[model samples]
Target: MRYYLNTQTDPAFNLAAEEYLLKSTNEDCCMLWRNHNTIVVGRNQNTLSQINPEFVQKHDIKVVRRITGGGAVYHDLGNINFTFIKVGEQTKKIDFSAYTRPILEYLNQVSVPARLDGRNDLTVDGLKISGNAQHIHKDRVLHHGTLLFDVNLEMLATVLLVNPEKYRDKAVQSIRSRVTNIRKYLLDHPTVEQFMEDLGRYMQKAYQAVLTRFSDDDLKQINDLAQKRYRQWDWNFGDSPAYDFSRSIRTPGGTIDIRMKVKEGTIQRIRIFGDFFGIDPVSDMEKRLTGCRHDHQSIKKILNAVDIERYIKDVTVDQLLHCMF
Candidate 1:
C-alpha cells in the first residue's frame, strides 16, 4: 500500500522524504509536498555555472542541488512542489509516461487545463507551468516537480542566468518565456494548503488508495534522515559540478576581487585580494576557507571565530564579508 505525506517547505524535510521513499523496500507509491523560496539545481548541474553568483550574493539567497536530473528552477512560497515515489518492479522497465498520466488526469479534473509536453513539463496553452525530474534507486523511482502558481517571475529570471554574456552568445531566450505561473490563467486557484487538500482527495480517487497522514514514526524517521544527509553539505552542495568563479564586489572601503576554484560546490581553492583594508591574518582566513563548504553563513561563521585584527590591517567586518563571497 502507498502513503501520502504533506511535508513542510524546508529543503531539509523535502529531501528527507526523497531519501525515505527511495530507501523503502515495499512496492508502494506516495506524494511529498513542500514549497521553497530558493533556487534548486539538478544533481548533475554545475552550481557555479548554472547560477549568477553576484545576484545570489546580493540577495542573500540559497542554492541547493537535489538528487535528481533536470535543469535549474526557482521556487518561492507561491509555488507548489510535489514528489511522487514508487518502488518499481525489476521484471518490467519503468514507464514514466504511465506514471505521470494520473497527474495530467487530475489537472484536467480540477479544470486547470494542463498537458504533459515533451518529456517532463506540464504546459497550459503554450506556456510551461510545471517542471519535473526523476531519480531512480535500486528499485524505487522518485519524480519531483515544481508547480508555478504565483512565483515572482522577475526574481526567477534575475537569479537564474540563462547564460553569462562572457560565454557563447547562443541567442538564449529569456527565462520569462520558459516558465509561466498558473495564477496568470486560473481565476480562482486556491492557496497552497487548500490546493493540497483538493489534490490529495483527487489523487486518492484516482489511485484508489486511502489518503492517510504521516504517523509519528514516519515523522521521526524523516527528521532523522534529514539531519543525517539532506541538511549536510556533503549531499546538498559538495556533490555539485566543478567550475571556476570570479566575481568583484565594491564595498564601502574599496573594490575586492574574489577568485575561486570550486569542485562539487566545495571551495577547493580561494584567493581574496582587493584595495580594501582588513586586520585579520590573510593566511589564517585563506586556510579556513579552502576546505569549507561554499556557503555564505558557513564562511562568515569561520571568519567570526578568528581574530579579525591579526590579518586585515583596517577593514571592517562587513567590508571583509562583502568581499568573501
Candidate 2:
C-alpha cells in the first residue's frame, strides 16, 4: 500500500484528490489529510437542509458535497481525515469493520479507548470521535472518515444546525450525535499535528506502506477536477434532492410568507403571501422568481433589479432575501 500525507487544507481540492486517486490510479493507497473550515454533505442529502446558511455565510465556511452516502460532517484544520482506496473482489460485501479496524487499533494503542460502537461510528466513552462513509466504483472501494482530534465542537454544532420545519424533502437527513475530541482523552494532550504524524507513522509501519507524494501531474489533475466540479455550486448545492421550502418572517412591512418548490436547484414554483400593503400584485414578483436558481446571490440579483417595495411594502431587498432563503 502507498501512504500519502496531504498537506493542502482546501476542502474542494482534498475531496477532488480523493476522487482522482480512486479512479485515475490503480494502486492501493492510504491518505491522511485535513480541510479548512468547511461542511461536507453526503451525495444524497439536501445541502440547504443540512447546514445553517446564515452562519455558514457569516463565517465564510466552504460547503462541498462528497461522492459518498452518509451524513454530513464538519471539518477544520484541527480535525484529521483518512481515506483508503483498495481494489477488491466485485462480489465482496461492504464491511465497515474491516476499514475501521486500523483506526480503532491506532486509537487504542494511544490509550484513547476508542471503539466501533455502531455501524459506522467510532466512539470514546459513548461520545462519537469519528464518522465514516464509503463509495464503491467497480472493483475499487473508497472508504473515508474523519477523526476529531481537536475540532471546534461549538462551531460544528452551530454550522450544522438547521430548522427542520423549513424544508420538506425525501433527502436523507443527518443524525446528530454527541461528540468529543480525542485530545481530551489523552494523558498528555498533543497538538493535532503531532497526533496526525503519530497516526500516519503507525499506519506506515503496520501496513509496510511506502510514503509517497503527489507528482506535479497528479496535483494538476486534482486542481483541475476541483475547479471543474468540487468548487461549483451546481455539484455542491444544485445536485441536492428536490424539496419544498417555506419560510415566514416578521419585518417592519408585516409578516411575509415565502413558499416554493425547487427541483435541480431551480425554483419551479413560488408564491408570496403577506399582510403588507402593495400597489402592485405580488404574483408578478413570484413569476419573475419561478425560473431562478434557489441561491442567495441569484435571488438577490433578481430582487435588486426590480422595485421590490412595490410588491411588498417597506421590505428592503435584504429583508425579502431573508424570507426567500
Candidate 3:
C-alpha cells in the first residue's frame, strides 16, 4: 500500500486527485488531504435543494459533486479527508466496515473512543465525528470520508439549513445528526495541521505504506479532471434529476405562487397562480419561464425583457426570483 500526500486546499482539485489516483494506480493506496470551505454533495443528490443557496453564494463556498452516493457533507481546513482506493474482487468492494475499521482503529489508538457505528459513520460517545461514503468503478473501489477536527459547526449549521418542503425528488436525502469535533474530545487538543501529519505518518507504517509524491504528469491529469468535471456548475448543481418545485411568497402587490416541474435542470413546465394583479396574462409569463433553468440568473434574464410593471404591478425581478428559489 502507498500513501499520497496532498496539501492543496482546492476542493475540486482534491476530489479530482482522488479519481486520477484511483484510475491510474495499481497498488492499494490511501490519500490524505484537506479542502477549503466546501460543500460536497453525493452524485445522486439534489444539490439545489440540499443547500442554502443564498448563504453559499454570500460566503463564496465551493460546491462540488463527488462520485460517491451519500449525503452531502461540509468540508473545511479544520477537517481531515481520507481516501482508500483498492483494486479488489467485487464481493469485498462494498464492505463499508472493512474500509472503516482502519479508521476506527486509528481513533482508538489516539484514545478518542470513536467507533464505527450504524451504517457508515464514526461516532464519539454517540455524536458523529466522521461520515464515510464509497464508489465502485469496475474492479476497483474508492472509499473516502471526512473527520471533523475543529470544523466551523456554526457555519455548517447555517449553510445546511435548507428547506426540504420546497422541492420533491427521488434523490437521496441527507440525514441530520448530532455532530461534534475531534478537538473537543482529544486531551492534547492538537491543531488540525499537526493531526493530519501524525495520522499520515501513522498510516504509512500501520499499512506498510510507501509515501509517494505525484509526478508532473500525474498532477496534470488531476488538474484536467478537476477542470472538466469537479469545477463545473453543471456537474455540481444541474445534475439533479427531475423534481417538482412549489413555492409562494408575499409581495407588495399580492401573494405569488410558482409551481414548476424541472427536468435536466431546466423548467419543463410552469404554472403561476396567485392573487397578484397582472395586466398581461400569467400564462404568457409561464411560457416565458418554461425551458429556462430554475436559477436566479436564468429566470432574471427572461424577466429582463418583460416590462416589470406589466407582469406583477409592484414585483421586481429580484423579488420574484427570491420567491421562486
Candidate 4:
C-alpha cells in the first residue's frame, strides 16, 4: 500500500483529494490529513440541522460534506484524519476492527491504553478519541476516521449545538459521545506533526508503505475537483434535504417571527409576520428572500442591499438577520 501525508489544510481541497484518490487511483493507499476549523458532515446529513449556525458564522468555520454516511465531525489543526482505500469485495466489509488495528496498535505502542469499543469508535478508558466510518463500492472500500489529539473541545461542544426540538425530520441525527483529546492522556504529549511522523513510520514498517508525493498535474486535477464540487455551495450545503425552520426573536423594533421551508439549502418559501407596520406588506421582502441561501451572511447581504425599511417598518437589517438565521 502507498502512503501520503497531505500538507494542505483547505477543507474543500483536502476532501476533493480524498475522493480523487479513492475513485481515480488504482493503488491501495493510506493517507493522513488535517483541516483547519472545519465541520465535515456526513453525505446524508441535514447540514443546517447539524450545526450551530450562529457559532459557525461567528467563527468563520467551513462546513463541508464528506462522501461517507456518518455523523458530522469537527476538525482543526489539532485533529488528524486517516483514510484507507483498499481494493476488496465489500459484501463482508461491515466490520471495522481490521481497519482500526493499526491505530490501536500505535496507541498501545505509545503507552496509551486504547480499545475499539462499540462498532468503530476508539476509546481510551471509555471516552472516545476517534470515530470511524466506511463507504463501500463495487470492489473497493474507503475507510476514514478522525483522531482527536488536541482539538478544541469547547468548539466541538459549542459548534454542533442544535435544538433538536425545533425540527422533526427523517434525516439521520448525530449521536453525541463523551470525547477526550489524546494529548490529555499522554505523559509527554506529542505535537500533531510529531504524532503524524511517528504514525507514518509505523505504517511504513507494517505495510511496507511507500511515501508518494502529488505531482503538479495531480494537484491540478484535485483543485479542479475541489472548485467544481467540494468548494461549491451547491454540493456542500445545497445538497441538504428539505426542512422547515422557524425562529421568533424579540428585537428592539418588534417581535419578529421568521419561518421558511428550505430545500437544497435555498429558501423555498418565507413568511415574515410580526406586529410591525409598513406602507407595503412585507410580501416583496419575503419574495426577495425566496431564493437566498439559509446562511446568515448570504441572507444578511440580501437584506442589507434592499430597502428593508420600505418593506417592513422599524425592522432593522440586524433584527431581520437575527430572525432569519
Candidate 5:
C-alpha cells in the first residue's frame, strides 16, 4: 500500500485528487488531508437543501459535491480527512468494517475509547467523532471519512442548519447527531497537526505502506480536474436532484409566496401568490422566471430587467429575491 499526506487545503483540489487516485491509479493508496472552511455534500443529495445558503454566502464558505453517496459534512483546518482506495471484487457488497478497522484501532491505541456506532460512524462516549462514506468504481472501492479533532462545533452546526420545510425532494437527508472533538478526549492534548501525523504514522506501519508524493504530471492532472469539474457551479449545485422549493416572506409591500419546481438547477415552473395589489398579473413574472437557473445572480438579472414594482407593489428586487431563494 502507498500512503500520502496531502498538504493542500483547497477542498476542490483535494476532492479532485481523490477521483484521480481512485480511477487514474492502480496501486492501493491511503491519504490524510485537510480542507479550509467548506461544506461537502453527498453526490445523491440536494446541495441547496443540505446547507444554510445565507450563512454559506455570508462567510464565503465553499460548497462542493463529492462523488460518494452520503450525508453532507463540514470541513475546516481542525478536521482530518482520510481516504482509502483499494481494488476489489466488482460484485462484493459494501463493507464498512473493512475500511474502518484501522482507524478504530488507531483511536484505541490513543486511549480514545472509540467504537463504531452504526454502519458508518465512529463515536466516543456516545458522541460522534467521525462520519464515513464510500463510492464504488468498477473494481475499485473508494472509502473516505472525516475526523473531528479540534473543529469548531458551533460553525459545523450553523452551516448545516437548513429549514426542512423549504425544500421537498427525494434526496437523502443528513442525519444530525451530537458530535464532540477528539482532542477533548485525549489525555495528551496533542494539537491537530500532531494527531494527524501520529495517525498517518500508525496507518503506514499497519499496512507496510511506502510513502509517496504526487509527481508534476499527477498534480497538473488533478488541478485540471479540479478546475474543470470540482470548481464549477454545475457540478456543485446543478447536479442536485429535482426538488420543489416554497418560501414566503413578508415585505414592506405585502406578503409574497413563491413555489418553484427545479430540475437540473433550472426552474421548470413557478407560481407567485400574494395579497399585495399589482397592476400586472403575477403570472407574467412567473413565466419570465421559468427556465432560468435557480440561482441568485440569474434571478437577479431577470428581476432587474423588468419593472418589478408593477407586479408586486412597493417591493424591490432584493426583497423578491429573498422570498424566491
Candidate 6:
C-alpha cells in the first residue's frame, strides 16, 4: 500500500525501476513515474514487426520491452508512465477498474474530461489518451499505463504498427482515429511541469502516503535486471511460441515472399521463395536469418551490419529485409 516514485526519464532506468519493484519486497506496493521519449514493446510482441525500423533507427530512439501483455506504445516527455505495484491479498481484491479509478479522478481534476473506454484504454471525446497493461506473479500484481498529454502524434504514427485494412475492419472506426491526447483538450492552459506536479500531488492524495524516492542503489539494481531480461533478444522477440508466418514484400529489387517458423521468437526455420533475382548466395542469406531474432530490428541489424557484400552484389539491405519479413 506504500508508493515508490521514480522521476528518472531514461528508458533503461525506468525499466529497471519496474523490475526492481517487482522482485523486491512483495507486500508494500509502489508507484513510479517515467518521463521521456521512448518506445516500449510488449513482452510477446515482435519488435521489428510491430515497429517502423527505418524511422526508429533514423531517430535514434531506444526500444525496450515490458513484462506485460499488450501492443506497443510511444512515450515521450509530454507523456507520463505510471506503475502500481501491490501484493494481491484476499482482503484487497485486485480490480482493474478500481485501480484505474484514481487515474480518471486525477484527469478530471485537471479538466481533461477523460473516461475509460475499454478494458485497458482511456479516451477523451471518443479518442484514446491512455493505454494500460498488467503483469502478475505469485501474490503480486503490477498494472502500468501511459497518459498521453500533448505527445508527438506524428512520431506515434510513424513508429507504431501501420494500420492494415484487416485490423481497421474490426472496429467501428479506424484505430488511428480512435486515439487522441489531452493536449487536444488542454488549450495550452497548464504547462507540462505544472501538470506533472499536479499529477504527483493527485497520486499522493489518492494513496494517502508521502512519496518514497528511489536511490541509486535502487535504480542500479533494477537497470541490471531490465538489461538482462527485458532488453534481451530471447525474452523480447523469442517470447512467442512457434508459429508459421508468411508475408509478401515489395522492394526496389522486386517482389518477394517470406515464410518462416518462429519458435520462442527466434527464427527456427525460413524459406525465401521470390521472383527477385539472387545477386548473392541465397543459401548464405537463409543462413543469416536462421537462429537470429525474428523481430525486425535484430534481423535488420544482422542483415545490414554483416559483411554480406562478399556473397551478394547490387543487393541493398532493404531488399534483403523485404524478402525476410
Which has the better lDDT: candidate 1, or candidate 3?
A: 3
Residue 12 of model 6 has an lDDT of 68
Off by over 4 Å in 1: 1-3, 48-64, 91-96, 158-177, 250-255, 272-288, 301-317
C-alpha lDDT of all candidate models, in order: 0.70, 0.93, 0.89, 0.87, 0.93, 0.70
**For residue 238, what is the lDDT in candidate 5?**
96
Clash-forming residue pairs, model 3: none
**Model 2, span 269-299: residue lDDT tens:** 9998879989899999999999999999999
The true-versus-predicted C-alpha distance at residue 165 of model 6, in Å, is 9.6
In terms of TM-score, which candidate is strongest? 2
As for model 4, its CA RMSD to the true structure in angstroms is 1.7
In model 2, how large is the Cα lDDT of residue 150?
95
lDDT of 1: 0.70
Off by over 4 Å in 2: none
TM-score of 2: 0.98
Cα miss at 178, model 4 (Å)?
A: 1.4
Structural similarity to truth (TM-score) of each candidate: 0.78, 0.98, 0.97, 0.94, 0.97, 0.82
What is the C-alpha RMSD, rounded to one decimal, of candidate 5? 1.1
Please give, for residues 191-279, the per-residue lDDT of candidate 3 as tens digits.
99999999998889889999999999999999999999998878887898789989899999799888889988889999888888878
lDDT of 5 by residue, 1-325 (tens): 9997799999999999999999987789999999999999999999999998878988999999999999999999999999999976474577888899999999998888999988899999999999999998999999999999999999999999998999999999999999999999899899999999999999999999999999999999999999999999899999999999999989889989999999999999999998898999989999999999888889999999999878999999989988876
Ranking by TM-score: 2, 5, 3, 4, 6, 1
Report backbone clashes per prediction: 10, 0, 0, 0, 0, 6
Output the worst ten-in-a-row residue range by lDDT, candidate 4: 86-95
Q: Give me candidate 5's TM-score against the actual structure.
A: 0.97
Candidate 6 accuracy as lDDT: 0.70
